[model samples]
Target: MTVAIVGDIGGTHARFAVWRDNGLEQIEVLATADYSSPESALAAYCERAGLSLGAGSAVCLACAGPVSDGDFQFTNNHWRINRAAFCRALHIERLLLINDFAATALGVTLLEPNERLAVRAGHAQADRPVVVIGPGTGLGAANLLPKGAGEWQALPGEGGHVDLPIGSESEAELWLLLHRQFGAVQAEDVLSGAGLLALYAVVCQRNGQPAQHANAAQICAAALQGESLATNALEQFCVWLGRVAGNHALSLGARGGVYIVGGMVPKFADFFVRSGFAAAFADKGAMGDYLADVPVWLVTAPYPGLLGAGVALQQAG
Candidate 1:
């Protein structure tokens, strides 16, 4: 049997698995920092799985940031992929590359009911577009369009870099602060892991309080413990996330639904469910009613990207 390999490479980790019998096996995760390049990491994975690469093997990689034909650079990491060189080194018959969020969007199509938790209740319109957005090392967004007969197309985009929207006077004030600090503030500037920490510090500065948390995890811990500043920052984070997601939904007319997939939101699922996200999502002045009927789901699947890369590989074949 021919061997197929799929990978989901992010800023921090690279997840690899073998595609066999239409499912993933021998799944392994390696820290990106542990290896100098993806080729090295994949070599380690193959060693652990007792496999060899040759002309009979095929590989698909879901990578962070925009993908192109020749060479690619990761948005949040130092790794670079020279497509032709990689294939030459691996001696693979075929290699496919796609944006990571595009893979996540494809993964949404393969989700089971239990893999997702509903954040809003509404009916999803069949055949309409679906929006996939998430926050991790960076913010990512994509759209999934159903093409009928069980086929779907995933559209990748840099939606995370769009201008941050302001909904209220307080948010406007915050925007000014952010602009002063970072010049031009994009959604990713305040919606990512590092952004969360920055938001916490800015919130403290805005309120004349001393910032206590140094990272996103610490801020989340403080919020769950009912620390005032931490709670406020987290709330703002969810609200901004909702605002950005709503913008994407509006841009794409995503009546099929919105799937939130990432490492950040799931960590505070309860708080997110109760936060200002819902109100902010549907807060568009006139389009509020339209957005209210659009359902939103938080993806809880552990390896959506890897699964999606396998799906992409199958689709290519």
Candidate 2:
């Protein structure tokens, strides 16, 4: 197709779209398991849309897991997308493989000013770096570095695997609990979707509650509906999310700000905004004051990856 093909490939699913006039169209959600490779899924999207992809088409994919060189192989899904191979299969002339976290970071430009609700109300320097840390199927982290006036570069990162911060007694106990499972517990060890389920299992085990083997959605729903164990786990999740965001901000010196993205937190946006996120983010030891001055924003755009993919394709030319 003459039009651009863009996709945000997550651990579990892939969101694909075509863009025009700074807006996303023909958005489709497809199961990564439904196809053996990214190209098959792309072909299905085109067939379903009744559109034809011309040879020498252009494409971009913001993928889950890490991105290096020109390929992006999904972590959870069994798909390895090489730039050259992918370009050939899809008949794409040019393709940009972007890390999902980097895609979220790219949203700093697309995000409206009003969407950036000030959680800290700090004196932000426009040119200062900004951070993006989101917890979904896994933890995604990145930053936005200013290039020039009205221009910024989204830098991919893997800070999610860093050591987890031990704070409260409950948190300490959880760390010990996780140590028995995974040899070394990282920040994402207890922050991602599976992490939430792990936390809930620990809580259930400790309290002698029946081990309810539920998915992330069920756990979230039960928590929202007033299940004690699920509710407490959700609360702990919020606190930890805040602490992680704070740690990222301090490490990056993100005086421009920090943003929260991904699909997991959107459901609990109200609680997250009014939750311990702000407190935990500002709860650093010696740098508490400094971190307090850093602003934080929750990315509210639904199709940020679509815009980001366009940005990457534009930059590639």
Over 1-317, each residue of candidate 2 has an lDDT whose tens digit, in order, gives: 33687888888788888865556788998998889998899888888766676322777889888888856668768999877877777777777788888887886578787665555567778989988888888888988899986878988878888888877998888778888888798888778999889888887877789856587788888888888998878888888888888888888889988888888888777767777778888898888998867877777777677778877777777
> TM per model?
0.97, 0.94
**Model 2 pairs whose backbones collide:** 1-53, 1-54
Clashing pairs in 1: none
Candidate 1's TM-score reads 0.97
lDDT accuracy of residue 64 in candidate 1? 97
Error of 2 at 161 (Å): 1.2
Expressed as tens digits, the lDDT of each residue in 1-317 for candidate 1 is 34589999988889999987668889999999999999899888988888876523889899999998868899888899887788888888688999999999998888999999999888899889999999999999999999999788999999999999999999998889899989999999999999998888889989999998789999999999999999999999999999999999998999999999888999999999999998999999998988988999999999999889988988887
**Best candidate according to TM-score:** 1
Candidate 1 residue runs with Cα over 4 Å from true position: none
Model 2 C-alpha RMSD vs. true structure (Å) is 2.0
